[model samples]
Target chain A: MAESDPHPQSSPVEPVSPPAPATAPVDAEWHRMSPRFVFVGTLRQLRGLVIPAAIILITGNVGRGGSELILIGIAVVFTVLAALGSLIEWWNFRYALTDRELVVRSGIVQRQERVVPYGRIQAINVSEAPLERVAGIVRVTVETAAGGTADIDIRAIAQDKAPQLREALAAARAQARQADNGIAEDATGAASTVATETPSATTGGELLRRLSTPELLALGATSGRVGPMAAVVGATLQFGAEIMPESWWDRIPWQQAEALQSVGVVASLLFVIAALTWLLAIGSTALAFGGFELRRDGDHLLLQHGLLDRKRRTIPVARIQAIVVGEQLLRQPFRRADIRFESAGGEAEGAAGDSGVLFPFLPRAEVRALLGQAAPEFATDPTVPMSTRLPRRSLRRYVFGATVGWVVFVGIAAAVLGLWLHRWVDVVTWQQVLLLLMATPLFAWLGWARWRDGGWVVENGTLLLRWRSVSRQTLITRASRIQRREMTADPLQRRVSLASVQLSVASGLVGGHYGLAHADRHDTERLLAMLGGPRHEVVIHKVPATVEPS
Target chain B: MATNTFDAGEAGTSRVIEVPERLPDPLHQLDPRARQLWRLGSAISGAMFVGIVALGTFGAARFLPDFEMRWAWLASGITLALAILNAWLSPNLRYRYWRYDIRPDEADLQHGWFTRTRQLVPMARIQHVDTRRGPLDRRFGLASVVLYTAAGPAYIPALANEVAADVRDRIATFANIHDDL
Candidate 1:
């Protein structure tokens, strides 16, 4: 990225600060982002055309049978317009470090200015646009705790300046907090610890774990991310088939496929598709987390990753609402899990204000050690073969819940395919259709396992709820951080005196909800009562008004 | 929850689960006039839906001269019947189920008979509060107190205007969270 490039020409700007800004002072000159920002941004906008342009060249013609020159003409017009827009946007962009806030002003048609208070700043990250693969530019996204959106993004800055600007902002934030708190040092150090990617481990930070090549590649192969990519690729292929000519359909080796049916050609095709998906997963995972490093400096966890983008994230240990230990279906055999912690009201799965996955792939046994040095709050390990499992009566419900739906669905499919479809077009043989019924036992077994795996416990104020579907997920959260608790039951459950409890903890735009279904009503009620649920009428006079409303 | 009378993890050992004597009752209810508001709201929306169905029926007649208005009539009949039923029966049942109480530390809510649900939102978690009133609601002299927490908005609907204001105040006064996180 351009941000990573050394900027020999750019002079270092002095750290400037006055008092806490009330609004904008007319006399103060606002600082402009890098001029290179504009050039890279324009190219970034044009990046979408690369695929189309390459396809057009390879095809050697324009279609819908349109003229080649006309296509190029349209492309040239779009390119010019995009470049002009980028240039104008860059010219209007301005930012300044106030005493307690970072003031940024930018708009195309509307005059917009955002003042992000340093205290509420969740993360100030150095990220690259997914398309800015070759471009040396970077994006400085300022995320606030207000919501899971990037409040301010300074796009396309020189690599070296990222560290400098981050430090200046940090220094101002420290001063601001110091004056605000009337203390020289706060435990949070909120923004005092400047977000830096230049090897922060040397500065009072402990390096926890850095994934090696074998580990990173292994993580890629087993990661749950492959499923979505495969779906996307499948969708794209379907779309492509719709757009392609009839001649394209003639290229397939269907006769060979039919001949190889006895050799389980369908299974082999599925295997091939799975392998391709695995390969794609590895490539994307490596690119995303090539040199993933986990470091802890007092109350914050610094994450440095992305082979190409070179993104860095700092998560305040105190802000974390819940930590998730998840074992994907493929990774279960290896006894590996990914550890990620969600902070309150921050962006999901991306470069800015990311749900911090400190250990993208780790041996399940070592999670305790990692949690101890990292976040001791989540160090309470709910053991395997949990003793607090759901009641045995709940087994029938779980098994019925999982199996009934699938059995019905499969039954309907078999009827449609074997009886109706075969009558008209011999698409599926009765025996072949009947083979699907074999999956019912698998579904039933999964349901039974889910019941066995479901467990909940509250110990030392840390609530642990464990459940397994296709993947096993164990959520560990502080009781105090839980924003709300919910218990629900249906008529059937009412008869059995069973209920489900869902606890919501603040994470991202909407809080994350984790729950266990079919817990005994008594246990659910007990759990709720423990988590501050009122069992008896509460006296209104006890809590003195905490705040005087304006 | 503080009782800790039993070990919860011992559930799988075939020990009998003690059914509690009774669940707590969030007995404090909404304003009696709130039912009229919900009824009016449902009726208006139902009327609009019937109007749309009638329009669709007429519009289709132009394209398909042979098109019978059977589906439209059936749909309109169902909508009106459901609307009438809702306006008559649901308002009372809903009012009976909808209950909320503001405790010192949290707000307790219970509703939905078929799928009973109870929610507890902590006082510290409340980010802001608003008293919302629509024209229809205003006509009925009812308002809703919405509590916006970091998680999401929790709604306590169909309160008297003055009562809504009081509830909003109590929630707002308690929700002034100063945490930077």
Candidate 2:
């Protein structure tokens, strides 16, 4: 409950007292980031200069001859400033590990001091971007239950020191947890074994799933990013046309290509753009998640992946709140859907901004095996499709739910194509308007598919629900992890005794809530009882309070 | 300069922070007498609503030269009919559906007329509870208890003063029971 405060991160920093400035003996145990940090940091800082530098080099050269000198001067100033900032940051950043907490002190002016107790640390992430990797340094981000925003980021540390620090922290945390629980002497031997000689634990732990080259390609090919990427490329093309020299535009063979083919220029351009965007999407996906691997350590799952920016995240198995299996419109045809964990860590990413994706592309049949191996708790029902589906009576509601949007869309489309434009009477015929209505059968089929796919099952302290739009999404969450449960029935659904149940969990920056429509009234009650205390009978104005009435 | 972050160490963290002092028990108790109060409130609101609609449309009709006075009267008449029906029927139905049971472990609330909602909040999960009494609520000797959890807030509307005090204290006790108090 205390963790639910929107500004929970403030507490961790609040607990830390002001550090003794320029103190000698206290600073003896202080650890500084690797010197390679400055070089990498400066390069990162210079990234902001790319656009301005490019503008000066290209556009400035269009009318003026002094572009090179201006570019050089600006580059020098930027380089110097970036280097100075990184140098100052490196000099100021210091962290010390104590028996009780890991204390970090950063910033020279608006100093930020954060103290995270070993017991409070939720997960640890050690990553190396391309430059950091090249420099043989890694960035360590220590996250508490307060989530990622309140992270103590050690931008660069020598790769060798990371394992020692992690082992030390882990050992201390285990001790704290044992002392805190006061009953974990049974697992004492196991705890000590992992904490002691585990510098190479990243790769040495039990292997779960490693996305093969072909599977990686499949994931890239079937990704939903192509749609968004096409939009981006369209914008980029417009920008390109604006910036290009007049001579370059004149040299193009667009008219030649348009004249040679049955397809118009717009259609041919769309085809080329589609292909380019798809290729870009694949390349970007590969760059982001090339060698994805899920490895398991005791009480924790370590995921290591990425080609250009190598990342390793240690997610404690206990922290996982829910599991989401998503099937894209393209991938559902192949019976493949990506798997994601809605862990209590308030990050929608693992974090690739891909919704906590553990397995990028997994076959529907094999998802159970992967979850069983990686996270056994969420892998209760393999089919995920075989849960308690909506009743046959709810089919009409689903059909109506599906068509309400279509009706609105068709009405709008009719207004635009058939009536709105006065000049397009001949081109945009009433047949086209009727043609759009032809998609009603497809929507009706969609409604049928939704009815077929929608299901909810509550058993074994886990809640499993499957719902779909164009793409299917299946959710598996433990009862105890649910932060909130709500059941609602609109006026229409009330007539048929159908209800909607929603469950929210502490995920992402705030939280993520998922729900299913048109569920049985009795099922929602069962769900309410899933994580609740004792169920008393309906007592209206009878049960007295702690004391007798006056 | 403080070298250590926390001087009290770990054991003292379990000390009670949210609930500092226990409240005195109330000598007088009363059940929620809210049925007539609720009906009167709705009836008043319905009358006011009809009056406003009649005045607003008629006012607009007067201001604009081409607008029809008959249409405004017709609009006001329709709203008046609907509001009278609602004001007569809904208050009792709402009171019937609203149910709240606060146990030592969890607080359960089953309410809503059209879109029925059931919220079961565990005592441990209760962030805070607030009892509010408005001017109108005081006239009827009624109060509302709002229970805030990490996820969001749920409310038990229109409770007697003594009952609200009792519910608040019981929730505080149950919540503290989860911690090492």
Candidate 3:
């Protein structure tokens, strides 16, 4: 009967009430976030000014005498101002859940209010950072279908209240959708439906997958982008050299050192660098994805992971535009691949590892099964021979495009060195020229590889394009997600009746454009037609007979 | 290959559906005033170039001992020749090649002289449409219709002022977009 109360809002309004009964009519009333939000807001404001304050203090010390106190006073004044701003922001912010939309009113100076319809919400993420965890609170972010501008972030809420808010919002969305579909429901019925749909810890979800510690370690070991690590190591060595005492350098006895000893020292240095990079990579991966678990709740996939700061991300399957399966060169031999998603609306830009990854490392064999279980619409026969490889003629084009310019530039440099510097033997030896000539064949092989790996396949309403630059990438995207279509051909491609087809799809900050080069002209036309272009008719011409012959 | 003859109602009257080799209608070219706008812009740029060259020659002659003014003059003369050629030729070429077609579902644009690029943007994907007029464009009574899609914005440049506004409104209508708060 409590669940069936039609006019919950009719109850007497109470301010600052503790956790209410499950059937309470708090939905229509404005509610301030958890009181702990003040602390979160203050910290956030302080974090923004930390670097500036540090710079001020450092410069104050270096510039003159007794200016330190003045700089300290300025820093204190800045802190007080920021704290007051945060207090005002916290005071002005209030959120209310109406029947149709979530209305958030906030802003001290601008007087801003955002009314987000429940039906438009794409996903809700509840994350607990280290500080929030200690404070016994969580941060909730609501994303809507209006792309970048429509996201709403609630900085701090009690941990227990988060799940309730999520459930309430979800039930509201479902009711709205049902109402839109012509389901006439009384207020009591809607209330009862919401009560029934509210999910508890043990209900409404099925565990799909979880990553073990060993798997996480493996993922870290095989993680891509070693170049950054190398750069970091180089920078660290340079810094170390600057900080080290002169005696440390003299201790190396470089004047009397033998070539073998120097070589050993260099080898050990490389070893140390590699070991440190590996350790750092592993440490970071474990921290980010230590206890990863993916669960399914109706149309949403809930992913929770982290070592220190737990994050719960709800991804609506419908908003996903594409799925990319990437296999790094080092991981390919082990038959492991990383899976990422291209979702339509969320943060415009995100950390490389944070936003898109569905899973970091999965055995290649299991990718299809995983996709089937999670996103069945994208599932297809992975072994199907639907891909059409680039033509042999394209190999020459690739080679010429990739290497000819560099080869010619090197040739000119060598010629200049030989003629102008009169140092052909020292600067541009015959061996060097031979090496430059050999690059042609080497680049030809690379071009052949690229051609072999490059292909496009259409199946199950999705276009799967596979291409190779440094590492091979396979992009599987639905045709409906494509925003634009372009067929381009240079003079050379036109002569061969070849064209490149580019499909623009909503992704990342600016959107992503993927192209399949050297596709047949007829195939490109067919692709256009498939993408809802005008239907084309083929005409046959008949030769006329001469009347004089009769 | 074998040819089969089918009977026709009238003794040799045969009809076949033809897939046209080119677009059904010729592409709509930019407004002719676009050429005048380009020429004005080029002339301003040429004047700036001449000023820079004159200043550099004067500075070198006054400051440097071994500086030869003839080489500077020759270089400046070559630049002015190129500028004049561009002013005379490039506007015509650009106007000839820039064409656009706005259909109910999509907009197709083709432009460029030597390396032509064609783009097709579906109406449903257009996020916003705007009409922009620069100072020179305002004097010429011309504007550009810029369509913003998720991919990026595309411009149909140098249309008559009213036409640009009309095109923008048409695209907005076709896209079925209404501003929402």
Candidate 4:
């Protein structure tokens, strides 16, 4: 394997032999991470100064010779200072693996140390940026089960040593699990013993799915990042217009052009904007997930992808908090969906945002098969009638809710015409009233569609909550993963005996909450009862205080 | 108060566990000193508002030729009215509505005036507990207990000092959250 080199140039300490025994000492000597980390750290510090440097250079008074020289001197000083600081940080940072914990000591001025137990490690990711790839090094990020951001990030390490570190950590975690099980067995004789099998220290894994070039291109084209791309393009265009030459505007005929010609210009501009946005989105997606591949290795799911910065993310199946299958407005008609995992720790590599997208784009028909193969635990029986649809009474609620905004808008227009403008009868024509009236059916249709798509299902200890706003999403998660369940009713909902059931899971920093809105109160209660039904040992009760005569 | 018991059927033994009639606890008021804390907070905000009004009046007198004092009076009157309401009426309403109870396996919180909310945090999901004392709380000999779960942190504000510490300790013990964890 490419990740098992014996002679690493960066490490100051000799590499510890593989498979450290389960009974290793509690306090191990600290070892510095790869010395190449100083380079990575310097790069990170310099990255923040790029825009400032560019601005300084662009706005510098080059005509005044001394001022330009001063600016260049200041830039050089800052670069040197940043490099020195990165070197100091690299000197201060050291990490050690104890018997049960990974201890990291860092900070130059005020010393700080963090200890993460092996049992708490949720996932490990190995990624390389363009610079690190050039240096033949990788960045390792360790995520704990704390459900916040990543616990620690080793910015740079030799590519060959990354896998060895991962293997050692996995082995420690397995031993910790065995120790925990042994203690539990001693406490309760009836407790079943868990197998103490370590993950195989090899690269081979069962290939579950791989995206081909054509499919990858299709994914890029259908990515749901058009909105962000459009914003970026709009900002860029605004900036371009500000910096554009005045002679360019003078060349165009503004007043003499025909109305049709102006309209044609506007239409072409819109087309250009849309095309640019589409091309940007596709190019970005292609760069991020060009060679996406998912493989199952022992108990971990390995994801490898990226074009410029090739990356690998290993996620244990047990750490996944929820699975989100999303169908965007543009891709639904073409029968495509995006699959994402909400894990306990930070996002996996190449996951553009907080979403740990396993596959950016996949055929809708094959989603079930993929889920069955990749994560069978989340797959439920398709034939079972588990969906509890909202009633027709709820449709009235939805329509009223949807149309309230339109009502406000029309009321404002009427007030302006009748009171301020005093053109009530003359300006408010029947055609305008008809156009306003048309919004009612449009809102009603939207309400009906939302009600049609919204439903909740519980099967095999997993709850599937499906809802739609602009796009439809079905969140599938184990009922046990839910930390809290809430059923709330506003005054209006209470009048209709409708309530919203919200389930909070331990995924993201604030946690992920999925709500099934406007469900019947009885049904919500039934669902809550079902969640608490299977637990045999513990039953909690709230005791009301007895009122005393005052 | 009613008791509902459900019987668990095993091969030879049948055991019944008593369940409460309601899923939430009966309303329990917060510390009486919370009213004083609320009043003090309102007073501080009211003082800041007065200062701002004074500054605005000075700015207008120096800068503008035709600055009406009636608008300033109206704004101050509205601000005072809101401050008075928050200082006097809101505290009572909040105290009446705010209630919390910690069970062996879960914690139930019911609060809010117009839009009532009831939240439950299972003990098993609790991550940590903290007791916070701000300046006013310290003056009033009161504290607030914050319970952190994986989802987020929820606070029980304006409890007596001893009660806050006791609640924090009890929750920490119940959740099995050690200092190191």
Give the best candidate by TM-score. 1
Answer with 2 or 3, whichever has the higher lDDT.
2
**Residue-by-residue lDDT tens digits, candidate 2, A1-550:** 2222221121123123323322112322666788888999999999988888776667665446775677678789989989988877876677777555665656544333444555545346677888889999887876543323435688898899877776776666566556665535522422322232222336857888888898888888878778889989999998897999999978989777567456476688788999999998898889888999888887677887889888877675656778888888788888887888876532223331113778888788889888898888888643544456788888988888777779789888677766667574444667766788888888888898888888877677787788888888888887666666777888888888888888866565445678888887666666666555343332223223423212
List model 2 lDDT by residue over B34-82, tens digit each: 5556777888898999999999999989998888999899999999889
Strongest candidate by DockQ: 4
Q: Where is the poorest 10-residue window by lDDT in model 4 chain B?
A: B3-12
Angstrom error of the Cα, residue A516, model 1: value is 1.8
Consecutive 10-residue window with the lowest summed lDDT within model 3 chain A? A541-550
Docking class of 4: incorrect
Predicted structure with the largest lDDT when compared to the true one: 1
lDDT for each candidate structure: 0.69, 0.66, 0.65, 0.66
| Residues A209-298, model 4: lDDT tens digits | 888888877887777778899999999998897898999878868676556457687898899999999999889888889888888877
Q: Which ten residues in a row have the lowest lDDT in candidate 2 chain A?
A: A2-11
DockQ of each: 0.13, 0.08, 0.10, 0.14
Off by over 4 Å in 4: A1-204, A230-259, A262-280, A346-354, A381-386, A391-393, A400-444, A532-550, B1-29, B46-54, B57-62, B177-181
Worst ten in a row by lDDT for model 2 chain B = B1-10
Task: Indicate the residue-level lDDT of A167 in model 3.
Answer: 79
Ranking of candidates on TM-score, top first:
1, 4, 3, 2
